[model samples]
Target: MYCYPPHPVRGHPCDNISGNYGTWQANAIQREVVVVGGGAAGLSAARTLIRNGVKNIALLEAQDYLGGRVKTHRQDGILTEDGAEWIHGGSANRLYGLARRMGVLSPRVPDSSYAWSAKTETGRNADPAGYDAAETLYEICERNSVLSQYSDFGYGKCYADKFSGEYRRNRGRRSERAAWLHFLEMWVNKDTGLDDWRDQSARDADHFTDWGLDQWDQWRAGYDALVAHLKKDIPAGTISMSSPVCKIFWDQGDKGQVLVVTQSGVSYLADHALITASVGHLKERQDSLFEPALPRAYRDALAVTELGLADKVQLGWRSSWWGEPHYNLNIIFTNDIQGEKSWLKGIMEFLTIHNQSNMLQAFVPGEYARKMEALPEETVKRHLLSFLADVTGKSIPEPSFFRRTQWQKNVWMRGSYNSYVTVEGGNTIMRSRQPLAQAVEKNGKPVLLWAGEHTHTTRYGTVDGAMDTGEREAYKIIDYMDATFG
Candidate 1:
């Protein structure tokens, strides 16, 4: 079986595609507002401003392509998400809501009918009780009410205490408990995209706001459909692709305006500059990117919050080799396994995708993610294939297609997924991101506004969170045409 036929290849839209490769030229272009970074937050902010009658908006993206972390990769007939796969919620989710109205959603797979199996790295069937224990722990973590009880705790403490208590109270076999407990440790690292959960604030998990929609799926065309839809209403040539904003001289101009300079020396003069770059990118470039430098409070906020890496290794075949309609093979690593391929410890499951039939993937998050990303493609495929064969004890057929994501290495993205609230990276200040979300002021009016997932208070690290921040910033400009910046 295969997935849907390939859609026509597209160049996305409004891409003034040129990079820093050729002869450099410097020029200044003026506009009402300048949007830096063409990811979800930037595109959302641009569209909202335009619709609210704020025309002459210029969106400058560093990379040649848009969609930032919402990127979708397609090769031959195989389609895989290089970044985000789930919309995370249904109708109330801003992106999912737009996809709903646009009727661009892909058909949902009957995942409930799928098959699941667990085995040790030594090719022995793992005790199902361990799998059961891990599954129960996953369910408990999903309950916001339960997580809230640990509001003052770190994720490491809360989940660990919970996992230990649950199995002890249930009177489960110690051997079975130990098996999944090892799996659970790796699972937490991957799920949170952090090397150690002690750094993860339990308060952050309790802060998540869920939209009450059952469907969490992908688009019919691909994730870029959302990007295209956001760009459709904004004027053509509004976006300058391959244009990375190197310096933002927010309060430098004599005309009480701002100057945003790209890497190629193209300056965009505008009344206000809406910055929607990822926190990772901002963290990396903050010192030099800002003219007068980000305020001390914002710098402190950046220090306390951390961005995590979550990389994927995907394989596609002509037909289903696993046989089951929805097959999930979970590998539970034992204590004895060690050596050169220890990085393989990060991968725990081989699960099928929702709408695609020919593909299966494993995510490598936390500490090993960067190490795995640095390996050569052939090396990765050979090791991953061997790992699969060892755990399954089956003569696994070679996949026709293989891919892995390197979000950490990608210059623009810096890391995969979103920000995590650190327990003690700096002073907690009650775990508030308010300073990071606040706008920079000039002459008692807003000149440099921030928009991105990191800005949302309750919904950090989600697509909806990013959308909310973008719209929130756009509305701020609309509401306060002239006012004090907070």
Candidate 2:
């Protein structure tokens, strides 16, 4: 569904409306706060706001459904994920706590060896992994970030320290160096979607604070449950779905009110509006327009920020032949025959399949993730067949069902959340979380605030990080309001 132009009728400036005499009195409604985007960040922000004694908050989401990217679709008793599947950094993740509290099924790592497969140049399986070989491959990947770097962004930057001779004394055979590099390149490409590892700054590489590669937890009942449970505390009708925010007009110069316009041609006026949409969503002019415009510092910070893509393609099998009692999954490599190279490919080369009984899933990230969204179904099926053939000795029958979700193409969420650090093509810590006060000075009082994953300093990109940021921003707003009005 295309959300088109949002024609806002010109009216009294917010400062005039917000004053005891003008716009503030005219447009100033009594809602505690207005939060844009009802995803993890938005929900967490609202919850925090209410807990902090702020009630009558309104949440606006572009999609009819609430859960932004953490949705589940159950078909024929098989559960399929159209958005988020795995929970990274289980220990510190607040979502994990919520999952357990809400009684949702938690995902655990299967304690067994995974299957491996080989494929042809045109993306056809050619080799199968013997029991020990797959284990050995897993060991190699476990010890080295090279595989992750290669799988994620195809930049091979994850292993920059190792590749740059940091581990020269412990290097493997010279003849195999080329092969290993090639394999790593494939991993990086699939993981991050960049052609050159150098395209990313080394500092950006270090930005991922919640790095849990060894173990990943999946939400069995569907990750969306958290979204629903969080929504329950919020009063009905507080959330307005299918409402894409067009522009935000903040009169920080005189009054402290923030006005938000929706694509459906509706206008909302409130004391404050907290933005929690995706970073990529900010790339749009419609998404960024603010009354009196944003400060140059905030503008520069937003301009420098980079958005990464993470996408998923889920396929369902009739039977659970892929799972073994020992290890419930395998990451079969069907490509990477050549040495390190970078480019987006049509074929599903780098794949990690999750064997969760009725459902099997493969993740395609970075640039290829963008390409997969446009690929033909038959071609995609062929690629999966080839991958399965290489990993498992037997050719499991064609999957009874197939479904995929593309974050890059999704309107509400332009791309998946990927973390980044300061040194690499990112804004400084000061710029990231600049308070609304810093954005503007109103009657000697600062106004016009900003928050989201992009505004977070310590933890950014993860759902937990988003929540932490939302809560932090809410308190900042409350503090600002009290300090000013009191």
Best candidate per TM-score, number? 1
lDDT of each: 0.75, 0.56
TM-scores for all candidates: the values are 0.89, 0.76
Off by over 4 Å in 2: 1-30, 105-107, 111-179, 185-196, 286-288, 321-355, 390-396, 419-447
Clashes of each: 0, 33
Could you tell me the lDDT of residue 138 within candidate 1? 69
TM-score of 1: 0.89
lDDT of 2 by residue, 356-457 (tens): 545566556665666666776676666666655654556768878777667777766667755332233332433233431243545643344455665666
